[model samples]
Target: MEESTINSSILGTKEYWENLYQQEINNYLDHSDPGEIWFGKGLTMKMVKWIKSKSSQLLPDDGDQIKILDLGCGNGHLLYSLYQQGYTDLTGLDYADKSIKLVNQMASDLGIVNNLKTYVADVLTLYKSNLIPERIKFNLIIDKGTFDAICLNPDLDLNQVKSDYLATLEAILFKGRSFFMIASCNWTKDELINMFTKSSQSFLSLYDEIETPQFSFGGSKGNNVTCLIFQRLS
Candidate 1:
């Protein structure tokens, strides 16, 4: 499907996300056992490696910790992986209550509760409320499946919503140095690149686009996922 067409339905509102959670909550719960979360340890390691490869050049001279915000951080798998790799300043936001609960429980169970924070909030609505600190910036922001969900929403006003989202991202992202990494399956390379190019024209600059290997379990063979990295330039 065309990117614009996908965004027209999914990226337009919170109701879309809520309904998605309602439909998928059981599947998420069923799959989130101790060793059966969406991405296993191997994939999580690969994700961290991809994140680090994109973010290493942006690290501070003093080696001060970098702040990472993971959008739609289901079960905190990626965040947990980052913590294991020594990146502690991490925060995750998602709209699903079940996901939040599961992630928190997972963190507590694994004893990394002190290093992570998970919030139940829509990324589109995060800035409107106090879910995140005002004027806060992140060195890195990661999105895996969030945008795909947005595009799956059946009521999004594609152009306007995407424009607003891009602007909001610009406002919240660290100026001139932050990196945004998004992994998506529904969008092809050209479509993803075009969307980022258009979105970055106003707030960021294209830094890199890399193809990442994806793993699918069960009877499904995972398709290739694209990881698009953008750097704030304004």
Candidate 2:
């Protein structure tokens, strides 16, 4: 990990995303779609459709409804999209203060003043956060680029980061009902499947796959992103 400290994304850190939202927040107010939607709105809408079709399975009717946590939530665009689709039990967590501020502003501006909660909390240290209630467990946890950033960090500690990340997730998921939805431009489906199924430190089971768009990028024959769903087994 020390050797990876010199990489580009590591060079920017949370500061880059903060500056990005600061400059683009006003622009987002006018535009229907904005920057680095991580693959784009097309894929996001595809995810929306997938959720719409699978809501009963994902949310169930146990009377608890559905609770979702957006890890490294950035500006909360994913939560906003979910909100537009009429799913309201949402919470977003980010390490950057500015990102949380922007997410709250985005929610308030959209008149989603009460349904969404955004918190500033480090994913790597999430278990220690007092912002979230101890008894609450999420029905779904989502990640767009959080893992990519974690793996790219200059200070990355494989053992500590992986342990903390998985521990926090395990602590938050509702037994028998919670799962994780991860979308990434940094990993392939096989790679992700193996990471959870084969990794000695991981306890996730492959629940399903979210079909991703197939498109060429950098002359490749596949999409730049991969979407995967994993359920907690422990």
Candidate 3:
């Protein structure tokens, strides 16, 4: 797909996702069997490990339940992994309405509906009008493919979008917390590092940068698919 097309596809305001959900719902009604697409087993296991490792380090005190917010939590697959790992306090934020529906359905199927919260709102607009409660500061926020999707759009004004994303991230994170961002992009490591450092200087401290192997399409390979774990410190 052309970059312009991909960008235009998701550039709309709230109405975009609402219409998307309606279409998905109609399609579901028309189809007899609809199968789910999963984040592959290898990828899921890697994420699970990452979550577990981070949670273990952060949650040193026993009986302290950690709150996690999965930004762009498509279908809640990562949330499901965290749920299986015994993290009960979880919330998923996704702009796609169909994704929220599918996530809720999956949660119900897995009997974890009670432990997860789903929100359908633009990431940039989440805090406007106090849409997200003040008491909801997450211990960790995980971004898998959300950043890639945002950057992949050709219609996006890159600098403006980055500024908005950074501001929103700072608003939501608690002091000394972390954001684990996994991305696959053509940008160099130094560029990404500089971007994060510049954007998060006021609210976050760069703690660790992990270079992990990530699979790419067409049997290609990429290094440092960059899992950045930034500690929120104001």
Candidate lDDT values, in order: 0.69, 0.77, 0.66
Give the clashing residue pairs of candidate 2, or none.
none
Sort all candidates by lDDT, best to worst: 2, 1, 3
- Measured by TM-score, how close is model 2 to the native structure? 0.86
Worst 10-residue lDDT window for candidate 2 reads 1-10
Model 2: per-residue Cα lDDT over 14-130, one tens digit each: 777778777667667668434567557787788777777878877745776688888988778788899988888899998888778778877877899799987888887777777
Supply the TM-score for candidate 3: 0.76
Which stretches in model 2 have alpha-carbon errors above 4 Å? 1-8, 26-35, 215-222
Write candidate 1's Cα lDDT for 1-234 as tens digits: 344565345443566545545445555457655433343455556678877775567675457778888888876778888998888888888887866766777788789888887788766656566767775677888887677776666665556556655655765677767888777767766676677666534666677865567577897655566667778775
State every prediction's TM-score relative to the real structure.
0.78, 0.86, 0.76
* Model 3 steric clash total: 1
For residue 48, give model 2's deviation from the true position in Å.
1.5
- Candidate 3 stretches greater than 4 Å from native: 1-39, 60-63, 200-202, 214-224
Say which candidate scores most in lDDT. 2
